[model samples]
Target chain A: MTVEAREARQPWILLTPAVSAVLLLLFVPLAFIAVYSFWLRTATGADQVGFYLDNWREALGDAFYRDILLNTLKIAAITTVFCALMGYPAAYFIARSRGNKAILLLLLMLPFWISYIIRTMSWINILGVSGAVNSALMALGVITEPIQMLYNEATVILGLIHFLLPFMVLNVYVSLEGIDETLEDAACSLGATRWQTFLEVTLPLSLPGLAAGGLLCFVLAAGTYITPLVLGGPTDAMFANLVFEAIITQLNWPLGSALSLMLLAVLGALVLLYNRYLGMAQLMKGLG
Target chain B: MGWNLVRVWTLLVYVFMFAPVAVVLLLSFNASQFGSFPMTGFSFRWFVELAENEAILRAFRTSIVLGLLTALISTTLGVLASLALVRYRVPGANMISTILIAPILVPEVVLAVGLLLFLNFLGIPKSFPLLLAGHVIFTLPFVVLVVQARLVGIRRDVEEAALSLGASPVQTFFEITLPLLMPAVLAGGLFAFTISFDDITGTLFWKPGGVETVPTQIFAMLRNSISPEINALGTVMIVMTVGLPLLGAAIARRMAAGRGA
Candidate 1:
């Protein structure tokens, strides 16, 4: 082989192992799930391998599944909104601060680095009937009884927000840091008030990061099984919980595969839409 | 006044972020069995209990071994892939990079279920090896992203200089490129370790019968009953999760400073 041909061939040789591994493990499994979704599961917990549309019809036609799917999206949307609302200001503060940025970022990241399960479990210590919030409230005469704070839709959203807020903050902070100082200065010089300057200059400029963070948080919140399992009530179970049940508890792989594909399809559509408008590559780069 | 308000808001945000962690830390020391507040006096009873618990100990052992294995496997693959991506002109490079990192974007539940179904279909027993494969899939993207970032920052001239100085491509890579990439590789490995160690969603689905990682054990414990032992486990996990990255960062910073000096 010529030197040029050899040089051209080297990348393929180097990439083969990792690429093949990913193809076999990730892509092949996904393809399997897609195919499995079309198969049948008997009442006896055995998979009947034949092409059938019953799983899709059952998953999509039933109100129970529809409601669960909608609830999952709603919870994810609410969690994303909360993360953005809470994260943007903190990110902005850290970005604008003249010093101690590292410490501030570390503080934001500390909880995030901890296990998601542990972080969700911590809420039990804080939000349980005899937990900290109730104890504090009772002491202050805010409420006479310990209100049920854990095991609710709101608590599930809170858990997700806590888990996803750091990503939002980090992404927003990256974009915020990328903003030229002079643009804000220019807006100020043009007689815009601080709020006006922020509304026009800063918010719009940092929107890419916000959008990226929001997408990520939504995807995470929508797909999370542990948060709902631990923090949510029976009624608050998201679509993922159903998937877990069908696969693990019920041993109905066909139905579970169907639900999994449905969830993936919805999330995939949202991501594709996002990519069409704002390229995923650019958004992810901004995230970093 | 506005600046002060913003500062206070940021402080409140930090408090909100750390409140649960603080509560967990405090509860770990509490002598109370119910994990309720109101000062039941500090004690190390939970830590002792945790140390004595065989189940938790076994799970901890599993998590550490799995994490180490994942770090080793993913980082090696990630370094090679990143080298191809950054150094060589490859067709479909963008597409390849996207595929590699796609796992991070996909829902963990979807990945877990898919893997479970795939493994089951193939009659691959749900074993540690399978779980390790699943974890490597989940974590390889992080390693690639980290190492790729570092590789991008490195100038091509350095490698070119080594090549011109009678170093073969492989020798140049091992001597010149690998040394430069070490910090990134180490960071990526640490990230992979932490991710694999904390993985509950994937581990829950893929772990074989009777096998448990720390997070899975903790999840089961929490579901069954709340205990100070769980608190102790949480405390240890928090320390590891927080300490490992900080330690890695410190080492990387020191290494960078030494190179500068």
Candidate 2:
């Protein structure tokens, strides 16, 4: 082959293994899930191989699943809001810091490396009846008895916020960093107060990052069963929990497949919509 | 005054971020078995207990082996993919990058169930290899991102310089290109290791019965009952996972500084 042809072939040869692996592993398995959703689980727990809409009907039509799905979305939405509320000030602080920006950014990223399960479960040690807050409150004589703080919807949201806040902060921080410092000064010189300048200038410019972070936090929080399992009360079962129970506990892979695909469609649609407008580059920047 | 308020808010946020970690660390040294605290005094009994636990030890070994394997495979494939992405205009470039990283986009539970179903459909047993494949798919993107970022910053002139001096394409890759990308390659491998070591959501599904990584083992132990042993284990895990990336970042920083970037 000519050198140009050899050059042309190199990228394909280099890319093929990774590309095919993704195709075989990620996309092909998604196809498998799509196929599995149409099958039915026999009374004996054996998956009956046939195109049946029964699982989809039950997954979509069941009031119990519907309620849990809505609850999950609500919980995820709450977490995203909290993350943004908490993340913005912190991201702004880090982004605007002088001499310690790298350290602050590194600190922000520190929690991201920790195990998601570990991070979620860590809330138990802090909010459990015998945990720090209870112990400290009891010491202070604020209450004679420890308040029940663990295993509640509130705690579940807290766990998710703890887990997802960094994503929000990082994305906002990246966005904030990209904004020229002069713009804030220009706003101030043009007779805008710091807060006014921030509201009119910085916040609007940073809105894209906020939206990106919100999308991410919502999708991740919505998909998580771990935070709920580790921290949520018995009644706090989320949509992903239903999917997990169907597959792992109930041994009904068909129904589980349908449930997961339902989730996939919802999340996948949101991701597509986000991509259409904002692009996944911001997500990548946040993730990396 | 406003900036000071923001700084205080950031400080509190940092405290919030570290509170659980602090609790885990503090309780790991608690002499009490119940993990409740006040004045039980500092003790290393949890650490001692963890040191002697066979199941935990086995799970730790399993995690290490799995992480190493994941790091190895993810780094190799990710580097090649990164090179193709950065150096050449690969066909369907946008789609290919998306596909490569799409594993990260999908929910872990979804990916777990899909992989489990896919393997079952093919008559494949849920085993270590299954777990490894799930992990590699999840982590390969980090390697791709890290390596590709570094690769983008590297000038092509050096590689071209090597090529013009009678060095084969392979030689230029191995000698000129690979060395420049080594830091990122190593950092990406560390990321893969850390991610695989800490993964639980997917591992819980892909694992065969009786097999456990540390995270899975911890999950089992927690589900069975919370013990002080878990505090010790959690502390250890926090240190390892946190330390690995910190080390990776530090190395990258040192190298970048060395290169006068």
Candidate 3:
């Protein structure tokens, strides 16, 4: 082969493995999921293979599934808000601090490496009936009986925040770090108060990061079943939980496929919107 | 907010983040059989119990093996792919990279169900290798992102200089670019291992009947007994996952610093 031809062929050779893995594994599986969603689960616990729209109709039209999905979105939205409210000040502190950025960022990212199940279970020790808060409070004569803090929607949201706040903080910190400190100073020097300068300058500038973080937190929380399973009550099962039950417990692959695709569609739309506006690079940065 | 107030808030947030897991580290040694507080006493009974538990040990071994395979496969594929995408002219590079990254954006449960369906369609039953395949797909995006970031930061002149010194293209790449990319690859490899080790959502589905990783083991323990030994197991796995990345991060930093110096 000629040198130019060899050079041109080089990239494709290098690219083949990863691209094929994604195509053969990820994309092909997704096509399978789309196809499976059209099938039916028979009474004998076997998938009835056919071009059927029954699962999609039941998934989309059933009020039970619809309520759970909306509830999932509601929980995710609330978690994103809590993460934003709790994470912004912390991100601001870390981003603006001197000489400790690496340490703070490492600390921020540590929980992400830990097991999600462990992190969700941590709240059990914290807020369980005989948990730390109750034990401490009872010891101090604050109350007699232990409070039932676990297995509820509130704890579910709390666990979601615990899992997601670092993402929020990291995104905002990256954004805040990119804004020149001089810009904030200039606003203050122009007779703006500290509050006014931040409100008018720093806050608006970091909105993109906050939005990116919010999108991420919402998508992740919506798709999670573990938090609800570990920390939520019987009625607090989210959309992912429904999908899990359908596949694992109910032995209904067709319905599970439909429910999962419905979720993918909603989250995929958000991801596409994010990619179009802010791009996936920011998401990568936050993940890193 | 005032600087002091912000600092206080930040301190509180750190407490909030660490307290949950840190409490486990402490409670793992508690003399009591259960409960989180009142400090009955400090003992290693739970750890001792965990040490003797064969199932937990087996699960941990399974996890290490799985993590190693995941790291090896994903890192190799990621390095080659990123080299092409970052250093070479590839058509539709943006779209291609997006597809590589789509696995992360797609929810884990969706991936789990989709892959299960795909495998069932292919008449492939869930097993260790299939589980590993799912993990590679899940962890591939991390390796790609990490290596691609480092690759973009690398200057092209070094390879050119090597080429100018009469080295073959492949030889120059092996000698120059690959070595420069090693730190990120090492970090990315560990990240892949840690993520694979820590994953439960997808693993729960992709796991064959009766096969268990540490996360799946913990999920079962949670559903069944809520053993205090779980805290010990949790502590060990937490250290394994968090320590790997921290070590990798430190290595990457030192390598970068060494290069700059």
Candidate 4:
């Protein structure tokens, strides 16, 4: 082969294994789901092959599914907001700190390294009826009885915020760290108040990080299954829980695939919108 | 005074972050079977019980084996892909990069359902091999991202100079480029291993019948019952998770400083 041809071929050769793996494992499965979403599930729970729109119609037309989707979005939105409120200040503090930044960053990352399940379980111990919080409250005479804290929508949101706060903080911290310290000093030197300078300079500079972090938090919170399942009551089950029950418990793959696709579609729409505005390349760079 | 407020707020945030972890640590040593408050005196009984629990031990073994396999395979593929992307002006490089990282953007539940459907369609039973494949797909992007970042930071002139010195491309890669990229490769491999080991959402869907990884097993156990042994297990995992990365960072810093000196 010619040198140019060989050089061109070398990249494809090197990329073959990784690219093929992604194709076969990731894309092919997603295609299968798309196809399956249009197929019918028999009364006996077996998949009936061939194109049908009943799954889509059922998922979309039913008020129950609609409410669940809305509820999922609501929970995700609340979680994202809380993450922003909590994480922005923390990230700012970390970025501005003159102390050991590496250690502080490591502390921020410590919770993430542990299993997510374990972290959620810790909440159970803290919030259960006879758990730590209740015992403390009772001991301090703050309440007459243990308030039921576990297995609720509030707890679900709390758990999500807990899980996602690190991502938000890390993203914001990266952007905040990138900002020139001189800009903040200049704003102050120009007689801007602390709040004004923060609002005008620091906040605007870190908006990209805030947007990226919020987007990630929203996507993750909306799609998470384990947190809701472990921490939520019967009324708090999200769309993911519905998909899980349909496929695993009911053995109804067609309906499950339909629900999965719908969830993916909504999330995929948000991602496309995000890409349109901020660019996926830039988002990934911030994340990395 | 304002700075003090910020410091207090940051301290509170740190406390919030560590609160649950502290609870897990404290509960692990409690003598009570139920992980409720009011310490019943510190004891290692739960740790002993955890050691004796066959189901959890077996699941832990499965997770460790799976993590090692995932690290090995994903790291190998990631290093090669990183080299290609970093060194060569590959056609469709942007598209390839996006495709590789797309898995991270997709929700784990969504990916799990898709994988389950695909496997069912193919009449393939869920097993270790299938789980391994799923993990590699989930983790390869991270490996690529890490190794690619390191590769980009490295000066290309070193490799070019080696090539100009009459060394073959293969020799230059091994003798020059590989050494520079080793730390990133190792870090990426460890990251992949940790992710695979801690994964439960995807594993829940694809794990073989009658088999469980540690996280899956923990999830099941927590759902059915609360026990001190689970807390003990959590503590062990926390130690490893926190300890390993800190240790790795320290070693890397030492090596870097030594080379500088």
Q: Chain A alone, TM-score for each of the models? A: 0.95, 0.96, 0.96, 0.96
State which docking tier applies to candidate 3: high
The number of clashing residue pairs in each candidate reads 0, 0, 0, 0
> Which fraction of the native contacts appears in each prediction?
0.77, 0.77, 0.85, 0.74
In candidate 2 the C-alpha lDDT for residue B43 amounts to: 94
| Position A252, candidate 1: lDDT | 84
Clashing pairs in 3: none
Q: Which digits, one per residue and each the tens of the lDDT, describe model 3 over residues B106-210? A: 998999898888886788878897899899999999999988888889999989999999999879878998888889789789889988998999998889888
Q: Model 3 has how many clashing residue pairs? A: 0
DockQ of each: 0.79, 0.79, 0.82, 0.78
**TM-score per candidate:** 0.97, 0.97, 0.97, 0.97
Candidate 2: segments with Cα more than 4 A from true spot: B252-261
Ten contiguous residues with the weakest lDDT in model 2 chain A? A115-124
lDDT of 4 by residue, B92-121 (tens): 888999998988888888888888789767
Which portions of model 4 show Cα errors greater than 4 Å? A44-46, B254-261
Per-residue lDDT tens digits for candidate 4, residues A179-258, read 99899999999999988899999999999899999999999999998998889988899989999999888888888999
* Residue ranges of candidate 3 with Cα displaced over 4 Å: B253-261
Every candidate's lDDT: 0.89, 0.89, 0.89, 0.88
Which of the numbered candidates is closest to the native, going by highest DockQ? 3
lDDT of 3 at A31: 85
